[model samples]
Target: MTHTLLEGKKGLIVGIANEQSIAWGCARIMRDAGATLAVSYLNEKAKPFVQPLAERVEAPIFMPLDVRSEEQMQSLFQKIEKEWGRLDFLIHSIAFAPKADLHGRVVDSSVGGFTQAMDISCHSLMRLAKGAEPLMRDGGSILTMSYYGAQKVVSNYNMMGPVKAALESSVAYLAVELGPAKIRVNALSPGPIATRAASGLSDLDNLLSVAEGKSPLRHLIDLEDVGNLAAFLASDRARAITGGVHYVDCGYEVVD
Candidate 1:
């Protein structure tokens, strides 16, 4: 019997909502590789969905976390440290923008939407990275998800593009700052993938078709693809790779 890539490791997979979730894919693969799991769902309303998924993966706990709330961030990681002593990895699979904001032009994006979008999508990454620092004393990887729209125009993505741009920037900054501690920070800028979150935005199905056409592979990205890459980044295989915004976008960024 042989353990695998993530053997002896443990991770916190935040933002899981359901079985179709990107975080759920990452959670499944990482667990398969032998890392233990802790999940974080936003509220009571989301608990039923997140709980069963966590149970399926043998995740020990599913705590409440709303990243916008600093109290929740601190309390959540404190629980991790108390129970697990420290962490080996963390996935910030959270991002949000109001539906109205996603439908409107960026120029038409309001002050509230801009604040909420950036706060939830970008700043939350920064906050989580900082919170994870102390408990990552043995050195850990912090990974976040981004999209091509952060670099180029993607209609109806609207304010989220800017939020992701800020997120990518934060990845660089956090990587450099956490380097001496032996922690890595990076992002996976994935191409279009159908998930519960993506379905929330308007015109996504049509846009996904366009993504398939533009992608060199002539196909869409999948949670498994992103999951494999994420596990690699969170492991010692990526020891020297920090501050990188790695793309799993099927070369879609190349053309556009």
Candidate 2:
């Protein structure tokens, strides 16, 4: 059954590529929890795939937002300001790295590849938070997706491991800086799943199998598992919570 956990709240969800996206999961859950949502698609090609999902949540503000493009990013927040006047939370779930760099050893990652990955995957959170800060006049939460690789090496995770490490660190620094304003910041690190983004990793099947076998739960997590936690963190129920790298990894992070 749907709940009013987020009733009267307004949130912005960035990084929905398809139905299987982690951001899509969060959007669906937050919408069900009574949030008014403003959702973003990466570009025209992604609009078609993301539009239906946004409609399902009755998102009043649907637009294009490529975090790499300052113009697009600025336009998104401007639209939100015009339509909603305020924002209660922001969900950032986008990350990218060149395929060659991602599939290779982290030590061999090139300057361009590392820079692109860091900019899109880690620094984008800072940019979005900057835009959301003013709109969050009453305070807000900023949630970004991270992974286990950020803290520990996972074979084939490659350059993203370091990128995510930086993201988690950014979350801590952001939490401290924004705390006085009552703006909370945290990272959500979910276990392996077959999402489109995860497909980029080499030998993903093996990774999933290994995680399931080793995890205390003996299975991988689904989008819903991640969504449930995200919805909680986005709501006032977690008002006092911030500066954490909360895991929805089914106890996988606890094992050897």
Candidate 3:
């Protein structure tokens, strides 16, 4: 049954690659919760895959946004301002690192690779928040995806561990910085699951198996699990919450 948790709310969802994306999960849930959404696809290559999903949710403002491009980023917010006037929440679920760097030891990661990873994975959230600040005239929540590796050494997670560490840290700092404006920032760290992005990790099968076995729930989590938490955080129900690293890891984060 759909609810009105987000009735009359407008949100922007970034980083949907396909049906299995965490962003798509959040978008689907948020839409069902009565949110009006504006979605972004990375580029033409991704548009075909993402456009259909956006339509399924009835997104009225669908555009291309490469976080690396200031032009595109600016255009996105401009369009949002023109169409929606204000934004109630934003979901950032994008991350990237060169394959060679990702599959190698973090210590061996090249300066270029690490920098790119940090820029796309961590700094982009800051940029998006900056753009969303003015549009959030009535306070808003900004949610970004993070992982357990940000805190612990997950064997093959590599440089992303540090990148995500920075992301979580940014969430804390941003929470304090934007608190006066009533803009909330938080990180959602979900346990391992198969996504097009996660497939980049070496021995992902092993990682999934280990998480399922070790987690208190004895199974890996699905996209809806993450979506439900994301929907709550985006709603007024969580107005008092911010600067937190909330986990939807099936109690896995609690397991030693």
Candidate 4:
């Protein structure tokens, strides 16, 4: 907790819904490590949920960013450019799928649903990276949230499996493209937690139970564990690490 690894860094944290959000966890840790932070609320509806947390982190620039809207995303970055003048790190913890597409089989998913899922969950990272690149004058780190389902099938994971797979692949490709600028990209694949997002998945209680039994740690991971890892990756300690899908899943991926 005494690490001043990011003392002089400036970062953007997107997709915090509430205190329980993974993005919130990363934000708190990044703030504690002494980084100046900026945060985005998805819209007016999400603003209430994110405001208090932003205050807690003392973020100077809080703005609205809906990745689907080029205007909104541009405005958010424009604000960043005006305020911070540069960006050192970014954490993308956003993903979404219409309930129908999320609950149904991949083959049964509608084109609209599939496209929306891919756009929000996978492609938005690319959009954000493009905007952040020019501002990362010295170099930076980009981290996105992912899950085990992206690699192997998990019952009830449905269409998101493919979506997250695409996300992880994007991390690899983006890392290669950005490496020359010293902009590192990585995907953090966390184990299931009872986050608001996970509540959308079918039979999540069973998944958690099974994961606990299967994982080497024998207990589910929590936000703090996630925060610790995220802080490390964003810090200079991880300067050499990039283009990897690092797991914070309590060894569950190794089981079976």
Candidate 5:
């Protein structure tokens, strides 16, 4: 029997596009653990996709959200407050880097591409964490996803690597800023996993092969691993863990 890890928690999970999305995995597991889910779709164009995924996760509150705009972020949170009053957790499973930047050399990355990538991929979490703070009456967990490219060089990762570096740093700073309030902030960094997001990177084929072969697990990272990790982080089990950029990468980081 699967015991409900989050028996009475309520939280928002932003950025699930489909079942293959890491956000979807988190939502599924979070729901299974008895958490009520509030989901945010990025835009109208995404509504069709987000609606179905939210249904599958049994998410009760679904709203439109675009992290690039403060208005949308504030509006979404405002609605959440009106409906739920308080939130127990927040999952920031959102990130984006342009296809052009991910397929070329870092030197070839343009100013526009770099800014767009960082704004959407990194700044969004900082925005959400700031926005979610007031409503977490009971100190709760805030989670964001990160990739291995942030710490080590991965060919064709481009500007997004720098963005993830900034995001990883934000986890620490937010952890410090929110710690006194009992809020925990952390990032779950995972290795290669085949999903729509990974499709943008040209090196995905070889990247997965190398990660699977060299990592101690000798297998590609799985979404189940990520979902379970999310459940643990959101629960009181990890109350003492904060501001950490924890690796869920099947021992890949330890290998030289």
Candidate 6:
């Protein structure tokens, strides 16, 4: 049984590539919990895939946002301000790196590739937090997706390990900066769940298999499992929590 935990809450979800995306999972659960959501797609190529999911969740603001493009981001927030008046929460679920860099040894990664990954995966949260601060008049929760690889070395995880480490660290810093304003910032570190993002990684199946076997539950987590946790963090039930990396990995992080 689910509860209306986010009734009257408004949030923006910035990455929904497809139905299998972790961003989509968080959007679905938050909407089901009675939160009003505004969702975004990367570009025209992605809109067809994301529109139906946005519609399914009844998102009122469906816009295009490429974080690298300040114009697009400004337009998105302008729309939100005009339509919703304020934002209660935001979910940053976007990350990327050149395929060559992702599959190669981090030591050999190109400067361009490493910089791009850090910009997209880590610094974007800081950008969003800056944009969201003013609109969060009543204070709110901000969530960004992360992985175990951020803290521990995982085979085939490659450059993302360092990229996510920076993201988790930013969450802590943002939490402190926004605490006085009552805004909470957090990173949701989930075990590998075979999302579109993970598909880019090498030996994804092996990663999943290893995680399932090592987890205390002996099974990997799914999209909905992550969604359930995300919904909690976004709601008032987690009001006391802020500036931390919350794991939804079924104890996989605890294993030796």
Which candidate leads in lDDT?
3
Per-residue alpha-carbon lDDT of model 2 for 1-256, expressed as tens digits?
A: 2589999999999999999999999999999899999999998998999999999999999999989999998999999999989999999999999999999999999999999999999999999999999999999999999999999999999899999999999999999999999999999999998999999999999999999999998989999998899999988989999999999988999898
Clashes of 2: 0
Q: How does residue 49 of candidate 3 score in lDDT?
A: 100
List pairs with backbone clashes in candidate 5.
none
Clash pairs for candidate 1:
none
Which is the winner by lDDT between candidate 4 and candidate 6? 4
How well is each residue in 42-147 modelled by candidate 6, as lDDT tens digits? 9999999999999999999999999998999889999999998999999999999999999999999999999999999989899988888989999999999999
lDDT head-to-head 2 vs 3, winner: 3
Candidate 2 stretches with Cα past 4 Å from truth are: none
* Model 4 TM-score relative to the real fold: 0.99
State how far residue 53 of model 4 sits from its true place (Å): 0.5
For model 2, give the 10-residue run with minimal summed lDDT. 1-10
Each model's Cα RMSD: 1.6, 0.8, 0.7, 0.7, 1.3, 0.7
What is the TM-score of each predicted model, taking all chains together?
0.96, 0.99, 0.99, 0.99, 0.96, 0.99
Among all windows of 10 consecutive residues in model 3, the one with the lowest summed lDDT is 1-10
Which segments of model 6 are wrong by more than 4 Å? none
TM-score of 1: 0.96
lDDT of candidates 1 onward, in order: 0.88, 0.95, 0.96, 0.94, 0.87, 0.93
lDDT of 4 by residue, 1-256 (tens): 6559799999999999998899999999889999999999998999999999999999999999999999998998999999889999999999999999899999999999999999999999999999999999999999999999999999999999999999999999999999999999999999999999999999999999999999999999999888889888988899999999999989999988
Q: What C-alpha lDDT, on a 0 to 100 scale, does residue 17 get in candidate 6?
A: 98
Taking the tens digit of each residue's C-alpha lDDT, what string does model 3 give over 1-256?
Answer: 2589999999999999999999999999999999999999999999999999999999999999999999999999999999989999999999999999999998899999999999999999999999999999999999999999999999999899999999999999999999999999999999998999999999999999989999988999999988899999999999999999999987889988
Candidate 6 accuracy as TM-score:
0.99
